[model samples]
Target: MSAPGNPGAPGLAGNSGSPSDRAAQGRAARKRVPRSAHAGWVPSLDRPDPVAVLERQGRDRLPELLPIRYGRMSASPFAFLRGAAAVMATDLAARPHTGLTVQLCGDAHLLNFGLYASPERALLFDLNDFDETFPGPFEWDVKRLAASVVVAARENGHSETKAHRAAVEATAAYRTSMRRLSRLGELAVWYERLDADTLLPLVRSTRHRRRAQSTLTRARRRTSLQALGKLTEVVDGRRRIIQDPPLLEPAGVPDMAALRKIFSDYRSTLSEERRLLLDRYRFVDAARKVVGVGSVGTRCFIVLLAGRDADDPLFLQIKEARKSVLEEHLPSGPYIHPGHRVVAGQRLLQAASDIFLGWMSGPQGRAYYWRQLRDMKGSAEVAGMSPTELTTYARLCGTALARAHARSGDRIAIAAYLGGGDTFDHAIAEFARSYAVQTTTDHTTLGAAIAAGVVTAAPEV
Candidate 1:
């Protein structure tokens, strides 16, 4: 498809190079691409068949995609629809122009943004989901965010016009905010963030005002001491994970013989100083904990660490690392190891990450990254948020998303492309509306599949 404004020419939003340079880059990137290059990739909007696209990808990766399958079992028809990324990916592949790319949160839905305490115990708001995060077209993130607004609005029984307005508002915030960042110096943009207090004034309505107040209240309650109280329990005179069935299960301790060997290699992944620092904490126990709808099945494990005194405790989560969904669709780049990718991406995107954030490649070649399990972690209650509260929350997500993008790319060029206009706002609204319809249809197909016994739900206890 031709770029948004130009006839017979594709647009790259931030391309400031000469026409020849831009043409050469585009040609080089697109040339010699395998048909299968687009095989697992979603189709462009000019050739829209979201259903077919989803089916193609689903058939290829059902086994890998199974972990994100749990919450659908008891969800509403619409909620079930909201959780289908495999299906959504195909629908998204079919959509239109403006190929400006960024390191996207990949799954930038409303619920993914929230409050998390930094290493210094300062609670801040930021993007909390990264399963689908990687470099790809910026429009993909916008489309996902906008469509989520529609789904959320529909669930709250709002009119399509109201939902559309919220999506438009969100896109406008992104465009306007990106332009604001583009004008700032690099250091200014890097240090910029929407801390909770700074964000409170942005809540426009009474409902949002109330919700923001409640959110702050909850965040204040989530101290490290509170996390220890909630996530730990005494088991036979030893502190252990309290079993909660599917949501929170006791993973049990790792095999002593296997762990002694594995940890030697694990120590090699740390810096010499960090390895020495870790030597202070004795490994007590470890267990698997299922977390989030999209990340449920991946091998997520928690390691319990303690000092000489059991009261001095630390919890760490070591989740499995895999290729990003964006990697399958975007142009290839430098081959950084996946563990390095996770650590670097987290450090770049988050104002600060867990102090323990580091990667280790096991003897079996499995890559895992370790981080504080819930270092004062909390999220905005999307289901509990009113429509106005959701809108305010969406704006927070958009603002944080723009800050993350500004870190690795030129904001000035991005600002020029957006040009303080409603073009992006209108375009994304169209995409969101269309994609939300597609999500509904795909959700139905998944329900049908479950009914047909094609995919089994994890047994409900």
Candidate 2:
């Protein structure tokens, strides 16, 4: 709660500046990029076609999956926002920025942060998705997260005032946490994490704690044995993944052999100990499994493996990793493999990560990263949340994001820039409201395209 380490840590030798000095510098930045300037949102006249961008990102994806992606995205404004990261990237590029870089959760929507098992098997809350992770202006992530709160609140039938309050609380928490963390030693800042036990005190009521407890219990049950029981059955004395139509089906017979070869290639990327641990399990089967609104079209697979006995199982997901949506607008250093970019960015941003996390090159040189299918993972159901619950959740997310940024960003400078005030929070809340309208407009445009037969989308089941 207090800054993690010694507040009186020595300042740079022969320098009059200290943490307060850095804070003052941040305060000065308000003149250059006025806080209020961020409150406005408008699509540029030359903004790229949203539908066209969706099609372009899908060019290399399985043709059969495109309609499914479009279908999932068309379900709601929030759903559409998830799949429209590319569209948002173009718009954010046209906005004024403070030029502060941090490893970003390129698609930092409400659903993307969740509880996941760390290497030590502790349940920790942090950013859980990183396909779009990139190094860019820190506020871009904040803006996306804040807008998500507003969009989600509106979808949940909350009033505009409630939505604005949620966004404001989140931005305020982000600013305050950053200011607190700025006083910590770098190592102390890096070591902070939001473990389940550590988070319980933040819950204001017995009911909320019970709900969190229930979620944790449910997550703990989501193990490999449980997945095997649900997704596989003994067929002719062999274990095989069940076929569930377009959602889950076996890959081509020819691709199975290629999968085995790449699975081995993936193993080489792990540590010696993990490779030994992994060797106990042999590849059993793999099936193309559609996942998430934005990732539906990508090459995502749930792989099954057997350990010393058939009863001992492991499930790993091999998901295609592509260049981040932010890459085109804000150039960063080149990455030879998109999978490495995702893996590296994830490691840099997450407080703790999966022990099995690794990347490999699949057939046709497509890049993919592999991790446990579902190890203590759960997300908040924003639609069912009360205003107070939503605000608390937003604050938690904001605090987690600040910790993530502090690990890789210039925390002192950023904290200084934010200062100890409500100015940035108020600006971000206004931005959230304006952007929520813009998201609605974009969602409507996609719906119109589908209605006009200009774009193809399957019916949501």
Per TM-score, the best of the predicted structures is 2
For residue 431, what is the lDDT in candidate 1?
Answer: 65
Score candidate 1 by lDDT. 0.63
Lowest lDDT sum, 10 consecutive residues, model 1, at 32-41
Q: On residues 279-384, what C-alpha lDDT tens digit does candidate 1 reach at each position?
A: 8998877666666565556667677788768878777777776665556545553435666667767777777666777877753576667777766566777664
Candidate 2 per-residue C-alpha lDDT over 1-461 given as tens digits, one digit per residue, 9 for 90 to 100: 11122111111122236777866656676665767777868777887888888889888888898888998889988999999998888788776676566778898888899998887888899999999988777888999999999999998889999999999999999999998998898779889999976887788899988887887778778888889889998899999999997999997787788888898888898899999999989888999899988887889988998998999999999999988888877655346689988988888899998878899999888999999997878887777788888888999999999999888777887887887878889999998899999899888988899999877898673
Q: What's the CA error at residue 34 for candidate 2, in Å?
A: 2.4
Clashing pairs in 2: 23-416, 26-416, 26-417
Question: What TM-score does prediction 1 earn?
Answer: 0.82
TM-score of 2: 0.93
RMSD from true fold, candidate 1: 6.1
Q: Tell me each candidate's TM-score.
A: 0.82, 0.93
lDDT score at residue 325, model 1, on the 0-100 scale: 55
lDDT of each: 0.63, 0.84
